[model samples]
Target: MNGSVFSSCLEASLQGQAILNDNGEFLFVNRAFCEHVGYTKEELLLLSIESFVIYEANEDLMKKEPIIKRGMQQKQVEKLILHGNGYLQTTLFTVTDVSDLNQGYYHVQLDKIVTTFDDVDFSMLESKLRDRDEVRLPKKILDGIKDTIITIRLDGQFLYANEAAEKLFNRSMEELLSNDFWTYLKQNNDEELLSKFYQLLAGEEYTQFEVYKKDQDEWFDVRAYRSDDQVTLYFINISNRKKMEKELKESEMNYRSLVEKSPETISVHNGKEIIYINPAGKKLFGIRSFSEGALNLSEIVVAQDQARMRENYRMLLTGKKEMTNSVYTLKRLDGKKFDAEATTTLITFKGKPAFRTILKDLSERKKVDDLIRKSDKLSVVAQLAAGVAHEIRNPLTTVKGFLQLFQKEQEVKPFYLSLVMEELERVEAIIYEYLTLAKPNVESVFSKIDIQVLLEQILTLTKAQSNMNNVTLEFEYEQVPAIYGLEKQLKQVFINLLRNAIEALTDKGTIHVRILKHPDNQVCIQVEDNGCGIPSERIDRLGEPFYSTKEKGTGLGLMVCYKIIEHHNGVLNIYSEAGKGTTLEVILPASN
Candidate 1:
């Protein structure tokens, strides 16, 4: 046969099977091939078989060479063809020898055309047919696919869904197709998402998005790809990932709030430098934003406390100490100082080693501590005063006795005797004031004393002095509970407070005293004055012996008053403000 006749015969015999050249350009295709791919014979010749397959499946077509080589060597190749309408078709090809006839001077014709389907069994034939049919059938392919696949129109209308998709959405394919795809998704009703969906229908492709199914009410991660006029989506449930992210955010917020509102100053330091500081720490350090290496721990601490702070930091860094809670003085940037109790611990912050310290301000506590020490010193002074007064009393008595004897003998002049007597009286007064500083016997002599009456008696004695000082004294008394105490001591306590009040008042100032019963069945006597009041700074030291503001003042008056009132099981409270006034309140338990 001629070459054209052989080519036509070979093409007509294979039915739907085709042939291709070495470059994969179609050489010839039979009528069956044209009908299977929805192309005419003339058109099929112009288009390569590779163009009919999907773009992603083009690689599979290129793999046909190896099979063709094997077939040429073994004489046959059975292959699957990808249909233009998105399917695979199995076909068989048989190679033949069509070598030219050229023997030096002339040509040697060794033409051969062979065809065989005898080796193809019925089962193999059936598999080929099935592969062809199944290629165009998505349901069959979807059932075999591992990932869940769903097809939707441009309007997000479900068209086709796989078994995995059906199971994940907890809905049948019919149900999914009946409703809008976004209706089942979480937050689909949100205005922003609804607008986005409209935009998606308007030719926008949503790549990887988060969606939720209506039936199961669960979330998924969806990846959508556009093909033709439809969108193919692949979904993966990511509820666990979403939940973890939410929990992490909440935990971070809680920790941040705790650090911000803590009463103590909190700071996070990387090595020797501060990285983060809380509000209290910022105020304590007198600066903001202490970034890396900006300020060292020693620089912020007071000079006297630097050694202790350094030691604590060293121990923390070396792991010799797990945590530290120590008190030290912290200096402000402005040079003001405050006592601080700092607690420190090692921590890792943002991939770097760091320490977190909490510092509590102890300035008010230090003031109280100083007062306690001063009070202790005053107690010693009181004891010394008592001893000196006792020692000097004997000498004063002997001197008075000798002066009187000399005056009677007429050896001493009258004026000298009078001067000696005046000196002796002054010495005696000093002894009396010193004796009041001695510790009082607290054992109560159980005698019911009308507190109002005792207060009136002391007030009458001080009225004459108040008039001399141009101070008006007023007293208010109510029927109050009586207390059992030494009458003489109680009177002395009243006199001492009254004298202090009178001295504190300027000319024409008023002194007010009120005696009443407290809610706890205790007797309360309050002495208030309108005078140049004590300063807050000096008020705490008012009761210490020998610590006086007045130059000629003994300062033992309030101290002795404190001792006497304490012996009577009473509490003394002094409230004063500079330029305001002063109030002294004494509370004593009532007798049963």
Candidate 2:
């Protein structure tokens, strides 16, 4: 029957009646039963039948439970029931297995309340009434459970076994119960299991551990709880969980192996300390391991870039940024500094927010780049040699002619001496300008520069080259603010622009150069050449490495010029038309 119809039938009964699960928990209680227990249906439903039974009677009832569970019904059993108001009554009950009505329910009928102890004979009532047709409700419930359950006596004799236990051991209930618990452990050669069972038997109250069943090839998480006379064990299968754990462990190991063997230096760090560093990172830092002490992030990064690195790392860990790319100078454990480009990204490390940084060593790359810049600088200087010689030769020839005239007269005239001195000073200026380009300066300091004056000096240096190309150089300017930049680098940029302008011309052409203050506190410099103009599409590729308009040009010179200008936080743009001249404009932020 469904729960409602069964509950209604029990509720309509005049005598005290209750339905209980195999564990003696009340599933349904009639009005008569509620009155007998002095509890509401709601209150009694929350309790078990034993909750009202006195200790001595409960123990006596528990003794008959095994017989009742084996399809025997106890009739007219005398038990003392304690009321909620601190009173006890002698009641007679008849408990019948009702598992046919429900899977694991027992029907208990309150036969009568006895006024005197002499009314019933205890000897005949204590005898169990055997009914072979009685439902074995407890066995059905225990067998329905997924986990293996067993009850064993203190002397290691197995008393009860569930279907799960029988299935787990691949034996029948009769066979499983026939074997003692200690004998099972001994037969399996499980000394650990035997010891744990011994611990439970020796007043341990509770013990739990995992055991692998070799014959079954499965893992079981076992828990045992002890009582005065018996210990109950529960074995929960954990084979799937164990297999997944193994796979996850292997995955983690594989991931760590991949990161450890990476060619680039890979490091994971929280804000305060480095959590992990790969072999490449260790080698780059000149350390065998981090066993020396906590490796603070500041210890490896150079002081100048540390603040920037910290900010970027914080943003990554906070999820404020996805990733950051920057070049930094890092110092090894031995204090040798090297350049590296680091990419920082956000990641979860061991279930917490952290930053992972992959550093690519830029030392060799920087060296090659330096060599290229130096090579391109020398190349430009060599090309200028002819024009510079021609420039200096003219002045030297003038001075020599004046000296020859003086030697002939054997007297130095003031006008002639002044002219000769002026020519000699012109030659000195030309040589000094030439030497500045030839000198190799690895690093330069930035400072405020007068853009107009720098341009004037560059024009003087390129004037000879322009003249040699049969080109005219025109300079125009409006008073503008100084820009903050490296003076030598700025000179290189302007010289490259002027030389390219001079070389663009096939015949006589005018190269106009102008400097002015732009609208947004910027200094604008434009170099326009009225020569064989560049094609519109090709202008975009002008500053790319190894790409040039001239047949013999390496194009590295213009690329270096672009790099220098960008380093100074400036922009270089080209505007060109096929038949028209090209204008290369540079914009630099003005100094305060």
TM-score of 1: 0.38
What lDDT does each candidate get?
0.68, 0.76
Q: Compared with the true structure, what per-residue lDDT tens digits does model 1 show for residues 465-486?
A: 9999999988888888778889
Residue 522, candidate 1: Cα error in Å is 64
Quote each prediction's TM-score. Answer: 0.38, 0.48
Candidate with maximal TM-score: 2
The TM-score measured for candidate 2 stands at 0.48
- Expressed as tens digits, the lDDT of each residue in 531-579 for candidate 2 is 7788877875887644789874546578777777766656676877776
In model 2, what are the clashing residue pairs, if there are any?
Answer: none
In model 1, how large is the Cα lDDT of residue 28? 70
How many clashing pairs does model 2 include?
0
Index of the highest-lDDT prediction = 2
Task: Give every collision pair in model 1.
Answer: 87-135, 88-135, 101-107, 101-108, 101-109, 102-108
At residue 17, what lDDT does model 1 achieve?
53
Off by over 4 Å in 1: 1-77, 81-148, 153-160, 167-170, 174-194, 198-206, 211-217, 227-230, 245-253, 287-299, 302-311, 375-592
